[model samples]
Target chain A: MAGAGMKDRQSRMSRPKRLRKTLKIPAIFFALSLAGLIWALLVDGSSDGLAALAAGSPLMALLWALLYRRQ
Target chain B: MSANMIKRMAWVHKWTSLICTIFLLMLCLTGLPLIFHDEIDDALNPSHWVPAHPDGAMLELDRILEIALQHRPDDVPIFMSFDTDRPVVNVTTGARPDVAATAMHFASFDRTSGDLVPPPDNGAAIMDFLLQIHTDLFLGLPGMLFLGAMGLIFLAAILSGILLYAPFMRKLDFGTVRASRSPRLKWLDYHNLLGVMTAAWVLVVGGTGVINTLAIPIIDFWKHTELADLIEPHGAPPSPVALHSLDDAMAKAKAAVSDMVLQFVAFPGASFSTDHHYAIYFHGKTPLTRQMTIPALIDARDGRFAGLRPMPWYVKTLALSQPLHFGDYGGLPLKIIWAVLDLITIIVLGSGLYLWLGKGGQRMDPAMEPLWQGPE
Candidate 1:
């Protein structure tokens, strides 16, 4: 039902709307970034151990890359 | 997932990742060679350390400690490590556990003759330099903290990237690399495919790395809490405590806890010690849990067992996570795997930047300035 509704909505929207929809991806990403920052400030200060965040970048890139690729 | 929210998040992820990508790339590159450090060192300087005759008598830890202290009576022995290749004993002594203190001493003794081995000309100075460079680029604690902040940002980018993945893939199939398209699209496709596939490994390494950075605080907390109780009511400020027999302490600690191997020792006033006890640290024998240490406080006064305190489960997990993140524990093969993964990471970082920049048609318009750059 939800998928059908989304399809209907997609058909109704203009072409630009489809491209613009992809843009929402970033906003959600940034909110998460904010949450991570707040958590780090509150819980643990910067240390070698916290390097996990930086280390996660490649994987993050890979993840997003897979999502955006054309069929 | 709202339009406004996605734009903001994309901005955050792009800028954050871009800022640290160069330095991170350097880290991965340098780290690649460093992973096989032990093997490289062995290959370059062979015969520096060789085993004594199998029939030769081995020196006891007690005698070695006495000899070590003879050179620096003021300082206390912090650690005693066995030589892997040679029958020599390496002893590290320090005036105090604080990093600021300079009155430190290191010595090696022959296992057979119990004679002091001369310092190697190439001392550990080079290794120490590499370590400092790897850790903070010689910027001390501030540099470390700065990198940590950057790491936090990078992590944000990662999680945000993951969230973005679902929507991006909503219309696309997994592993759809469009190599026939523009260079940017091809690279982008490769990046996504590689990144998602290695997601688990990356997350584990990254998350653990973040946790590992808290080592200083964790040790500080442990010292403040566990060691504090053991130190108070210092019996006469621990009168140069007649250096207790290390063998005995080892035996007692082993007897107290079965299925554990002795990792190292922390003398009184050392980083892991109280004023009145020599902390004998032991770690699990298993491959997975070997890094997790359990310290037994041995009263320096009488060489009697003082107390045994196991690390909290979280702390133990932290201990285990570090080696896993660094990929140094298993062997050279594992280090090779780690390096390959690191290279994959670099490609992913570069491809992501390419995709973000190649957006719309104009690659780099001077009119539209980059919002940010890496820390100066």
Candidate 2:
């Protein structure tokens, strides 16, 4: 079927994602998150404000992702 | 990865997320209000009551215990804890020394006058009700363990989600919304983005929650093993007819752990202590060591110092796990962040359900279904 041939072409276009590329930004966010979580626990007072911001990398990434390049 | 492998991961991701989605939603909803429970309680019950004798000499600990016992004539004393910021000491009494936490009655007394500190229970009942639902669903230990199992499943769903994410976004960039695409792809993209961003926090919260559910078992293990051995040399347990002065015992316990502040005291014959000694617990005033308690035992019969012991590593792990889960350690800012992340997680869960329901065909419900099977 002509439709079957098109489906085959589309499936062929589905390439496997590069592991390094996929994990690049997520890795950075994860490291920052871990550091921030520990920092909050190890100290207190005004530093806690800093710690919360650091732990909020994901939130930052999230904001950037949603608003990065609007169509 | 092979297409089949991706399909397998998808299978795992789908079912696990589907099974635990509802419970996770419940947890997130209940957990939102609980994060600021302290603030809510404070706002609801604005206290104007002060100590009876601000400048007068302090009331003896023994006298306070006596008054507490006199107030609850039929109940036996279990725990005595002091308020960190004020001159109030809380006494917890129950029908028996080894009763469950639910059965215990907690009342605060002014250290200056031995007068009962009244808490206008304005919104406290609501918070208590939410706590019960959040903790055990009112089913006690079994319910707690059941939630713990759910937490483990949630973790599985998270990890599997992460695994499947790599292949899902193979062609697309990070944070890709694909709003112009079909509804399924847009939601799928959103779910992946939110899932990855919120993974670490949810993992930490979920893991610590599992640890917390094991509290009763952990405490029981400590009591039956370490605590029992420590009290072994003191001979068989004996119920003291007239216990020695609690003030004297407190003084001895304080001297043993001079650097740490008093946390609480477990009376003799209590589950937290032997029938021979009063287990007086203390902790550092600093944020790091605040919850890590070191207990000093004092003989109840003659008020002798019975040595100080820092809690074993397991108990310390349990202690550290508490604040991580509660998000209470780093003050208000951290709590706000925790609340935001919790909301994001709720959205992620909802979107996941939406994506599945939109599959339309019943064929998609079983394993090896969904996106990968579209034309393969």
Candidate 3:
């Protein structure tokens, strides 16, 4: 019974470790979204192709996140 | 951070958010429709009318003003603005030069043919209703100031929310919405996630919004302080008199800033001009610089060139903030991004309200509740 209790504690602790591993891709995508928005503002021309990338990347990231809910 | 500090911050986050949520929600919803206002207006009133003369030269500014005056003989022309894509000139006339915007009459005329352009029934009434409510709750400057105060509170709430995020997420991973948990906890997690994701945008928009609400005062200050020298040369305010040729004034203005294009002309005694000058405002040809205006003051009596005064930093900030807040500069796709973010804000506001209400029967976390609740 004591061994089982110790195992339960270890499992709880390991879940966060697992979460950290899964977080990498989504976290990078999220950072990309923020960077893209800032870049969009800094660009000189209006509605330029680069501006489109800056604006579209966040929505794409959002879609990706929604599709892969675990991340 | 200590638990006590987190508790104090949470207390602040709750009350500030609770106070401004409804107003912020209204702003977000109203603002969503406004984001596509140009597209909506175009769809409603398709521009089927063409320029009267496709090949002919545009009539002189003086001729356009004369034609506009003929339409409203009793009213004086307060402002004249040029359209970007067409040979149409928009003339704003009022009972007096200093008349308020609500009392002003606006009409468009073809500069080439000197003919009145048919006004489109563009659902302007509904749009104006929404705009007035969104701008000032129909209470003019006072309402604008009240909303500005609310914006400050909303900003405070956002800051406190961010501060609390670190503590709340200490035990959990980022974006971890526990759907299987109690509904309140689920929404709480969502609120945190969305809140953090949108923190930058909300800060920019909210901060800009607060600045926008102070527009009237800022312009007034500019007129009184920075523009005092310009107006001082004229001495006592001049009485109404026959104005000089607008075409000559525009020509002189063109000479001053040949690279830029004339955007608008504020006649004497107009809010944007001195009592004795025609403030000819010009904008750069480029996309970004077009948002920044350069005003050249022309003596209204003689159409002589007065000095061009560059706008101060604050005024420039106000101009830039207007577009950034609207997200209109980057075109349709940017508007879509703005709309999605706006919807997310609405959800955040709604879920926040839900969480607060759901806490009604449950025992309140003493740390989360305000100090006045006393050991609860």
Candidate 4:
């Protein structure tokens, strides 16, 4: 239901309004970074690669904010 | 939040960040190379030497030690550590068991042939120099404690930054870099975005770095409290007697903790061992547990098996903080990411300084200007 509502909201919601609604993506990125750090610490082998990718979410966010929309 | 609250938070954020920015910059710079510590060692010291008898049966630990002692006739072993992936045993020796770090000498011997294996590292003195400065500014405990205090102030700045972030970001979207806007806004947005994006990582590294700075005191506390208590039950230590066989004691310790791999052996009278026991330390077989170790005590006199002494909670906390702060748990990719993040942190810090020096306060929105403006 929430996902459906978010989609319905997305149809008319501007990107800034969408972002300000709940600080959704940034919060998710934060969670991912923290989890990735702990995940990398806890496991080994190829999972480390996965963990690194997860931890690099902030870097991705940085790039996205730089390249995407400009006002 | 009220204007009064925002002003107070701004004042705090300004001062705290201003104070620790230089030191934190130094930390980030030095920490970049440290993240690739293993790779650096491997690159600097290209080791082409292989085991003399790779498949042949390895020599007894006792003979290896005897050969090591014979090589350094005047010195005694302080600590013995093993190489995980190679057939090498390293013995650190000093004139006496209790000696300062500078007075100690280290040598490695191949376990199979008992031949002397030259220690790795052609030269990395500059790296060590950077690491030392990063750790304590070469002021020893005082420097460490001072850095820890700086870390505390840095965290306060982060908190204030967060409180202040909400007001600036109220209208602006998350990570909205106004690069085409005036220089100040561009930098301000840059600072905010980078700071908030890297905030989680910064907190982790900063918190763990603070914990790491308290290592000496924590270990000393453990030694005096829990470690002392553990050894007390064994009664007052007896006079010096003929030392028992190390191989036998190792065998007993192996039998005691068969699942763990040997990390090192701290002999009696050494800093890490009691005066009457050979503390054989073992780390678990798995990756995470490998960071932690438990030591089994063997009576130095008769080599009787004593119970295992697991590190207390605080020591474990320190052990775990190491990899978290180092960003070494993952591989080279993680190190590269760590370096990039660190470099971006430098920009965030540098731009913050730039913003503060200019009309940052005077240029604030009219109402908020009075709140942030200081004597320029």
Candidate 5:
């Protein structure tokens, strides 16, 4: 009975931890989208290297999130 | 969230998505080729003839106008535009100054030699076909307005989908596609995942597209209100007099705005200019400012500078929306990103269609159990 209780406790604890991990990728993507939009608005040349990085971040994040799911 | 609220949101999402999916799909497919329009044009019509004036000593604007007129004596000049990289001037002429665009004759002239440049076969017919279908479905203003309405519905669908996302994802982890489940559930996850990921891009592009569709009306309003007053002092438009030296007018316009380069000129009696003025439009050298134009109105009768007309906020917004919607401002890499995002959006749209159809016309409910709740 003690072993079953311990296992139940461990499973409950891991649920929130997995939820937090799942939240991380989306949070990063949200930040990247905001930054990219602002940079595109304020910067003079959006075609340059830095602007490309900023503008492409959302897609890149999506790619990373997809890959993370596969793992 | 409450189940009632989730149901309401799902209803909105379903209806809006269903209404706009076909039109949105058409836009994406046509937009894919438009993203690289310049490169495609260049590749198809390679410029073989070098500029006659290698030293960049361009001929007088008046002379070029005269040559253009000689080619089509019956036609009157409507607009004249300059080429940035080459010593060539493009002139548009028609039977009347206010002729419709379909009736206009366009030709290029060598700026230095006054010789007619051999026109390149740019696959114009195919490009026009794609552009017309993408822009207005060839229905003109009504088509544009209809598409604008569709764009609004698209925006509504995106917002409603976002609302449903919270409830749908409450029990599931983010980005979790249940590949082992039935195909419907698998596509549902993809639709949600890609939808949320591309939300910002869709919002901006979709919103800007709506703004762009209003361009003709906005320009008409500006002309009727602002430009009408500017030309009031000159009285009713008089009979067509021989226009003053375009070269002199161009020089004066250049003097007025030393930093800006001449982009185009609207001839007198054209929609863009007063009956007595040559509307010389100038644009800044930088990428951001290049999208905007400042008009320097010159009296065609006297070749004198009048004044620079200030653009209202709405007009400025329209100007800004052009580049933002095109995604060409950020160079090739940004364009590629736009294309990729565009393709992803297609998948999202396709998956949404599959889910709705795959359910055999049943009402979609957020609280519904997964299609494959047990082992497949």
Candidate 6:
């Protein structure tokens, strides 16, 4: 009876442990982003292609909509 | 999060991943072949041409240009690049003497003997086709923008996936994929576990690609802002300013940068150059990051070297993103690893779509009760 009760308590404790593990997702993402930023800073020349999207173009507006409309 | 917020996020995750999944799968598939393209190309049509002598004096640039121009008199050379590994030289020429023109040709030469190396028929044509399909899907700018939008959706899916992961894993371990459980549960677990492991790589490559797709606009912006003063009516006749000799212009460009090597030269009439300057593009000397360039523009009239302008932070970010996106940098081992990760991503995409569609179908079944009722 005591062992059964202990197992139940252990399972409950493990619930949030699982939740903490999920934190790795964002942690990994931010790490990659940081690495990219660092790599970008070290390079000498890059093509500046995105700055062409003016505010008036329908395509630009569409892209902005897709980017900003996060759930 | 509120119930509504959760619902909204779930919706976004479902739709975004669904829309881009197919194209992403195609890209991933085609890209796999491209990663080993050089090896594959060599394996099939082995090079037949050999140098006249290994220790012979290499041909001069002016001599090679004379020979190439002899064959095509009307065409003018736009760029020339030397290959380090092979004794080969490639010279690109165009009718209009500009990059914007489509009537351009590339001729290879045996550097030692200066003899024209005839290209093998259909060499790399299939690989080039696959690459173009992956890049623009034959749809041009609209195709690229459409893919960019998909990339943006891919980014959102990645974020929302991270959020949902927290809630789903609230009762599970980090790497526990319970294959003994129901198929749906097992796949869900696998998806979460694998997704977390590859999260960093996917985000970096995807984010950079999103920025890269914006290349057209960025170049336009650079022109509008930096080159705006030089913009003049297109019909202006050629100036009387004495054009600099190619050798002199190249030497001046070389003198501007101490350690790097010249990769190519954009002629004066090209878009990369103004009407009176040659844009000499130079790259680093190392394998770790040679694709990253440092360009110097030289005045053609006096061979005056314009100093190097470092790429802006954002633009530099885009450049570094290219290797990460293509997975061509590092080494062959890294390429293999990239291909494996790409396969894993396709699996994740497919599984996510299956889970969403399966759940939707289950909800429609009258026999099954709703998992979670919305707030009153």
Which candidate's TM-score is highest?
2
Model 3: which docking level applies? Answer: incorrect
Point out the worst 10-residue segment of candidate 6 chain B by lDDT.
B367-376
Residues B4-40, candidate 5: write the lDDT tens digits: 6666777899999999999999999998898888878
Candidate 3 vs candidate 6: the TM-score winner is 3
Q: lDDT tens string, model 6, A1-71?
A: 75367436545665445445546444644464345434433333331111111101222222343354211
Query: What docking tier does model 6 reach?
Result: incorrect
Better of 1 and 5 by TM-score: 5
Better of 2 and 6 by TM-score: 2
The positional error of residue A22 in candidate 3, measured at the CA in angstroms, is 13
Docking class of 2: acceptable
Q: Candidate 4 chain B: worst 10 consecutive residues by lDDT?
A: B367-376
lDDT of 4 by residue, B114-133 (tens): 99997774656777787888
Instruction: Give fnat, all candidates.
Output: 0.14, 0.55, 0.13, 0.55, 0.30, 0.13
Q: Rate the local accuracy (lDDT) of all candidates.
A: 0.63, 0.83, 0.77, 0.81, 0.78, 0.64
Q: What share of the true interface contacts does candidate 6 keep?
A: 0.13
Q: What's model 4's lDDT at B55?
A: 96
**How would the candidate models be sorted by lDDT, starting from the highest?**
2, 4, 5, 3, 6, 1
Candidate 5 Cα errors over 4 Å, as ranges: A1-31, A41-47, B231-241, B361-376
lDDT of 3: 0.77
Report per-candidate TM-score of chain A alone: 0.42, 0.68, 0.46, 0.66, 0.53, 0.38
Query: What is the fraction of true interface contacts found in candidate 5?
Result: 0.30
Q: Model 6, B307: alpha-carbon shift in Å?
A: 3.9
Candidate closer to the true structure by TM-score (higher is better), 2 or 4: 2
lDDT of 6 at A33: 36
By how many angstroms RMSD does model 3 differ from the true structure?
4.7
